[model samples]
Target chain A: MSKPLILVTNDDGITAPGIRKLISIVNEIGDVIVVAPNSPQSGKGHAITINSTLSFEELNLDGPQRDFSCSGTPVDCVKMALDKILPRKPDLVVSGINHGANSSINVIYSGTMSAAVEAGVEGLQAIGFSLSDLKWDADFDQAEEFIKEIILKTLENPMPKGIVLNVNIPKLPKEDIKGIKVCKQANAKWEESFDERTNPHGTKYYWLTGYFNNMDESEDADETALANGYISIVPVKFDLTAYEYMNELNSVYQ
Target chain B: MSKPLILVTNDDGITAPGIRKLISIVNEIGDVIVVAPNSPQSGKGHAITINSTLSFEELNLDGPQRDFSCSGTPVDCVKMALDKILPRKPDLVVSGINHGANSSINVIYSGTMSAAVEAGVEGLQAIGFSLSDLKWDADFDQAEEFIKEIILKTLENPMPKGIVLNVNIPKLPKEDIKGIKVCKQANAKWEESFDERTNPHGTKYYWLTGYFNNMDESEDADETALANGYISIVPVKFDLTAYEYMNELNSVYQ
Candidate 1:
């Protein structure tokens, strides 16, 4: 049987340790092609470059996988790869061993998960992996075996169309990990407290700063699972419709 | 009783005619404040400017409403408005008399809808309005009464938290247009066909272009409603968890 083909990408720039680690692991499982943004695109959720042109070039990175760096957002990298780079439709598209958690409401703001969602929208099996730690050199090794296991399992069982997995691993040693839990997205949000500052020209500017507020206490909440030392897998869908509220909304419009 | 504090914003930048029309209509309904991007941010879905500092300056536009143009994406405008600009939490947040359609799958890539989703995430009553026409000079006046009615109705009945309205108006004259229909987001996607070309420097570049492929035949779909010349109101939620698939996904993981 032919090996599974995997497309690798991330929100972090092409040189980030997270994507490198992900590429290394996927290489053993599939014929890999890495198409990632040339610049860091954290927090750039689902953004596509419409007003400008996109350019990409092949990179001589040390890897068994072929690497191409593109000047666009993470979602753009996925689109570009599928359109211009990949030889054919990949068996699986995996985005990130991201440096931070995308466990709850953070999923909407995450470039990592957005790439995965974009792939899902394209009718491909995809997953986004994130670690709870947010450091550049974060310990991605801790979740290596778990990531490998998840990928292998997913390859065996293709995800439903319009659905993708958002897998967030806890920042712990492999031995300390409490295994995987499929959970719902927890209700959480960032409370923005912009740091107002003045530039050298004395014009006031603001730095975006905020703290995460987790409000879900349910046992099946992804945040709770992560807090309990389990790797959290949220089966996320791109259909944003609130089907339950349709009847109520109809009355309002009437 | 005090007037409703209506916050107005858009992805088409502050000076667009679409927003000017929106501001004019909103001014008559409430004490309005406009906080929108300084430049067009179309297709910049849910992006926040985390890596860079943001700046906003008050613009003396011809209106009764106070206007501020922020140097960021549509989501940033909402955050900045809530944190620094608005005197209090707004009674309602309305984004876009957008110069394009944001119905169905377009909502995922829409700056207009992202601003509304951001407001919804912050637990505000929010609605994103868009027209099917993509021209800057599109006839926004055609649906003024409908837009006003929708806003008034939403204020009377606040949206449930984590939910917002994605309202797309058909490009028809008010008289020819059928009344509103509460609907589900249609299953549709963009078939990307990159317009590849060479720059002056002989480097290959590509412009993102695509045709909308609406695969939905259901009568209750937002796209179907729009096609029938009726305004479509899709209740959109940000909680992306595919709850129905959790059990199936769990079995795979195990």
Candidate 2:
């Protein structure tokens, strides 16, 4: 049987340690191709380059893998890979061994998940991996075995159509780590407070800063699962339709 | 009581005719403050500027409406407006009288809808308006009365918490247009086929082009309403959680 083809990408530039680890792990399972943004595209949720031109350069990085760096957001990288770089449709698309968590509301602001979402939008099986630690050198060692297990499982039994997996690993050692739990996104948000500062020219500008606040008590939520030391896996879809409210709102409009 | 403070913004840039018309209509409803992108930010879905420095300049062209043009995405404009510009928390936020349709699957790629979603994240009542026509010279006169009615009603009775409206107006004249219908997002998607072309340098590039394909047979979808010449008002929220699937998937993980 032919090996499963895995397409990998990330938002934290092509040289980030996260994607390197991701590429190494996936290489053990299948043929891997890494296409990612040339620079950090944090918080670049689903944005695509429309007004400007796009360029992709093939790279000969120190790895036994195919790689390309694109001058665009994560969504653009996925599109470029699928349209320009890949020889054929990949069996699975995986984004991120990200520097930080994409649990709860963070998934909406995530470039990592956006790539995964874009892949799912193109009718491919996709998954986004995020660790709960932000430090660049945070231990991804613990996530290796589970990552392989999940990838193997996904390749064996494909995900449902239009659904992508958002898998977040809790910051724990392999021995200390609990099993994965399927969960929903917590009703959480960031309280944005811009730090007003003056530029060198004495002109006032602002830096967007925020503290994440998760107040949902729902134990079945991704936030809750992460807080309890389990790796949370949420089945996410790109459609934002509030189907239940349609009938109630339609009556009001009529 | 002082009228509810309403923060107005759009993805079409502060000087776009569509937003100017929106500001004019919103000026009568509340103390309106406009803060939008300095240039067109189409397709910047939920993106926020993190690595770049942002600046803003007061514009004199908001036409009797106080306006600031920010060098950022639609989400950044909303954050800056809330944290730096507005004196206090706004009771409501309205984004766009956008020049093109943000209906069905387009909402995921829309900078217009992202502004409104940002407001909902901040716990403010919000709505995004888009007309079917893409012309810069498109007549917005027909939408005046219904827009006013929707805004007035929204201010009087805010949306259910965490819900924001994605409203798309049909392109018909005022007399020919049917009234609004609250609908769910249609199960529609963009089928991308890149338009490959050669530059003057003989290097080939591609323009991201696609047609909208609606797969849902449901009559109560946004695309169905818009196709039938009725304005569609879809109550959308940022929570992309597939809640129903969580329980069923949990069984697998365990």
Best by DockQ: 1
Residue B61, model 2: lDDT of: 68
Clashing pairs in 1: none
TM-scores of the candidates are 0.99, 0.96
- Tens digits of lDDT, candidate 2, B1-254: 99778899999898888998998998887888899999999999989988777888887763556888999999999999987889999988999999999998788889999999989988889999999998888999999998998888777666777789999999999998888888888888877666677889887676777687889868888899988988889999888877767666766666
DockQ computed for model 1 against the true two-chain complex using alpha carbons: 0.92
TM-score, cand. 2: 0.96
DockQ of every candidate structure: 0.92, 0.72
Summarize candidate 1's per-residue lDDT along B40-101 as a digit string, tens digits.
Answer: 99999999999999999998988789999999999999999999999999999999999999
How close is chain A of candidate 2 to the true chain A, as a TM-score?
0.98
Please give, for residues A127-165, the per-residue lDDT of candidate 1 as tens digits.
999999999989999899999999999998888799999
Task: Please give, as one word, the docking class of candidate 1.
Answer: high
